[model samples]
Target chain A: MLSAEEWDILRLSLQVSMVAVLAVAPLAFACAWGLARGRHPLWVLLDGLVHLPLVLPPVVMGWLLLLAFGAQGPVGGWLAEHGISLMFRWTGAALASAVMALPLMVRAMRLSIEAVDPKLEAAARTLGAGPWQTFASISLPLAMPGVLAGMVLGFARSLGEFGATITFVSNIPGETQTLPLAIYAALQVPGQEQVVTRLALLSVALSLLALVASEVLNRRMGRSHVRD
Target chain B: MFEIDVTLRRGERTIALQCASAGGVVALCGRSGAGKTSVLDMVAGLVTPDEGRIVAAGHVLFDSAGGINLAPEQRRCGYVFQDKRLFPHKSVEANLLYGWRLIAPEQRWITPQEVYDLLGLAPLLHRRPVNLSGGEAQRVAIGRALLAGARFLLLDEPLSALDAPRRAEIMGLIERIRDSLGLPMLYVSHQRDEVERLAALVVEMD
Candidate 1:
């Protein structure tokens, strides 16, 4: 028998994760494109910074986020003044997840973009496409497989984001307790073992599902690029 | 109308090109890396030369002396790459319509239906580039450039990537594009046959 609280946590987790993924998509695409195409010294530094969160301890990342966006720090201070809050909220969890997923997204997109022929881009230009038009039309779509893979991987990463989310947003039940946080909360209590197990199972299942979907999508995209 | 006289000093390799034109295909014949495409790059505002004056259709496209270089999209010339660089995300229809969107709507002299007819692209209109064949892709590419309101056309080894039969097919498509569009053209090819088949004027590179 599932408790109402457990179900509420589960539902909230899904909502927050999906919103997080949706919000991060555009940012990820831009970062990936810059890393793949933009040629400036600063681009390299920024690329490294985006990938930094992937290497840093999630707890440390959360601490940094807490400082910068905690309704008191610069970003957070500005957000609070603007009547938007992220600290210890579900949105904060999403941001944390987004930061964690950024590197993977950038990596996948870069690979796909690199695989494309530079000559093709030159061709697009000669066809009278402005730079932005060329990017929107040629670069983005051809990098679709990578984009899809990036999204799936990001979603999966966000689904299990534990330390950074917990540290940055805190595990406020119903408001910010994502699946991993909820599971962590459940595990701390003696009688909530069953709930923890269920959520854990759900996480594994979702990750597997995402991987399968990416494989299928990539294969299909490959085929379309090949034959009748 | 296009005219170019340029000397590109690349580290040590000097790419030299000389040609001038008003309204006909100017064939640039040379071995690979003989600076044929490099010349087109300068005329289309893709590359800046060390010393050059380039004029296209009475416009100052590029001139090292004047320090003037127009951007590619602003030049209004059509360029067909060897690989047929169609937008992968768009349908054949959308890719063809891309350049069409850039020009003033009223200034457009080419129609999608006409392009479809010219390239035999009707059956493939809804399809993405990933589904196109070698010959079909090149034809669509040619049609796309023509419909994009190009006053000048550049074909850079337009048939180099295909098999002999596919190459022959694409060559004919190139001819059709040139004949129908009536735009001034600069065609780059090493194959003398290709030069003879499509060019009305020849500029041989050493």
Candidate 2:
């Protein structure tokens, strides 16, 4: 029931969101683990920085990202010299969305990591597992439910990201125009109300599906964790 | 011979313990909060003594004066906690093999099959720790430690969490393991009967 252009936008949205979630998951997990376990005094500062994106206005966050990652920016210039340019590209949209989704991912993962019993880690160490090995074998697997939930939340947030994506990478049709951008573009023109309505419905359905999937996965993990 | 003379100060209380064992089960028996667990933990390298020395199986595990403190993994002391603490996400086989895989093949004294047979764990190999009963879980924990090439085993009231029958069963199994493996062990318990039955040396603490 949709035109080829609409399909392109939808597909691009999925691609960008998936890439965003995948790209940021490892970094988010590391930050979460550090916040949950590390006793360093700097953890308070790190925690605030990680959650800044969640509280800041999306436009402000987008502007900050542009300042740090724009072609003229220091990091961006160095990366450009290496032939990797994120400016005004789909990769730029992914970067913005990844930043936006990072706080949600880290929060979910931190709570899960904290739930894992430290005594279990101690037992693993007694059994000859080193610190990294214990984390890989015990902490990571036990916190898998949280990790999965975080990933789903990140994916959903990335899918719905509009303000940051728009500011960082303008809504160029077939390039940066994702689901939310297309919906916004459709709203600006008269008699495109129907397009907007369909896209809105699709977004709600996708978000709902992600929430339901996360819930089901979390429940299963909880049951498996309950002792015999 | 195994020797431990450690001093740990926690707030207003200071626990000083000195004990030695000559190649058999040695029991640290005392009331709760008498630092029995602390002594075991210090030997396992989980808790560092403020000032003391610990020697087990000819290895100087800890010497505060000499500044030699080995990490828990490097200490090679298999600790069976009171709650078993078997990895919840891992299967029985994986839990048993968790440490076995880390040790060099030449250092491995006990094989996986030996552990499985010793603990009667053949049927529960594929089941997760969540699916195991308390007694079964303890057996798996013991089996896991044995396979890790433990030079010495530390059982920290491993049977306290079980029922009377299960406790007796595990006690008998512990005696069997001690006899068969000939590994020196430091058993921490408050139960008089448990110490009387299994320990060759009983170090009573207040």
* lDDT of model number 1: 0.80
Q: Judge candidate 2 at residue A127 and give its lDDT.
A: 84
Which residue pairs come into collision in candidate 1? none
* lDDT of candidate 1 over B88-191, digit per residue (tens): 66788888888888778876788888878877889988888877887778888888888888877778888776898987777776677667667788898987
Clashes of each: 0, 0
Residue A78 alpha-carbon offset, candidate 1, angstroms = 3.6
Judge candidate 2 at residue A142 and give its lDDT: 88
> Once superposed on the true structure, which residue ranges of model 1 sit more than 4 Å away at CA?
A82-84, A220-228, B116-133, B159-181, B193-200
Q: Give lDDT tens digits, candidate 1, residues A1-228.
A: 557887787788778778877888888888888888799889989888989988999999999999999877999999998899998788899899888888887787677777665666676777677888777777777778878888887888888899999889888998899888888888899998788888888889888998888777667556534422
Q: Pick by lDDT: which candidate is best?
A: 2
Tens-digit per-residue lDDT, B100-193, candidate 2 = 9988898799888888888899999999888888899889989999999999999989888789899888988899988988989999998878
Residue B15 in model 1: shift from native, Å?
0.8
State the C-alpha lDDT per candidate: 0.80, 0.89
